[model samples]
Target: MDSASVYTRCQDRLLDLAAELTAEQLATPVPALPDWTVLQTYAHLAGVCADVVGGLVPPSDDTTTARQVAERAGDDLDAVCAEWRSQAPALLEVFARETRARYRLPALDVWHHENDIRGALGLGAQTLDADQLAHFTVGGLARGWAPDVPGVRVVAVDTGQEWLLGERADLELRAEAFELARAVTGRRSVRQIAAMDWKGDPSAVAHRLPTLPAPEVDLAV
Candidate 1:
């Protein structure tokens, strides 16, 4: 499906999942993110969905994004979900007319947090949207998350998709497409990212990976 479809479906899914959860589950610690609970992640995501339609992306960074979540991360679970639901429609409407470039951030954010909530609740995962994730990882490495050193050649074992970042590439990383995407998006910790097969200095490359917040637990690889 397209990015907008992905965003809308994900939002609906999270809302449904949140509704099924108790207040305690909503507050469950997500080791995948630093000092954040499921409610906080949802609040952060809902905040961004609301912010995008209001014509404010607030510069894609940890500090700013955290502030957005903090602003709306009220104590009441139902109230927090309501806050998110209220703004989801406008974000979906905007995504319908715009390209992936417009919705990519929120789309990926939602997916990343989907796994985060699941992981936190000890809910087993089956698979992810590999097609979208593959492309998102490429864009992340190329633009928003580019490493400063020589490019590392990333090879997705399942899809056989490959991409290079930086100059004279000496590093090689191989893993499931979804795993790499998770690591790049900060859903997985440095340890989990390093768990993937590599030929070069994985530590060096790991340091450069994007930081949504380093997960406390080992994420699926």
Candidate 2:
């Protein structure tokens, strides 16, 4: 699918899930993302959409702070979802009018956040399609964030996907895209990575990945 189509479909899926949640459920802690509840996750997702869209078009020299974005979204989960829904069309329109090279934010964030919400809500039974998975894997590796660790082949066993960063394929680790993404982003443990086989030191590679803050459970009480 094209960028606009993907954004629209992602928005639809998010809204559909949002509509099914109760206030209590929305505030409840997410098992997958222990740091954020459903409500907080919704808020963050909406805030990200607003921030990115606003960054692209911008709002007349009005620079919004992170706190402001969170505050504006408030604790009303549905309202936040509605705002995201409203923004999606405009964002899609803007994206359609522009070229892919000009697209703001990394492509991984788009799919990562989508998977994040789905995993948190237990709605992602089906994995990403072959094309999407390949895109994410290759794009992630090419992004060059992985450290110069020797013998580490970042492999997604489910998809038979592998990206050899260094000279040797000494470490063979297996995980789903989300898990792999999280590991690459330093949010999850390499130990949590299933079917992991390694010859060299995994810690060196782990250090190269971005250190994601531990998932927090703060929500509207």
**Which run of 10 residues does model 1 get worst, by summed lDDT?**
139-148
Runs in model 1 with CA error above 4 Å? 58-67, 73-75, 98-103, 143-148, 167-169, 211-217
- Over 109-211, each residue of candidate 2 has an lDDT whose tens digit, in order, gives 4455556665665564324443453444445554664444555666666666677665667665555554565555434444433223455566656544433
Cα lDDT of candidate 1 equals: 0.73
Task: Using TM-score, give the best candidate's number.
Answer: 1
Each model's Cα RMSD = 3.0, 5.4
Candidate 2 lands at a TM-score of 0.69
Worst 10 residues of 2 by lDDT: 212-221
Identify the candidate with maximal lDDT.
1
Error of 1 at 87 (Å): 2.2
For each candidate, the alpha-carbon lDDT, in order, equals 0.73, 0.54
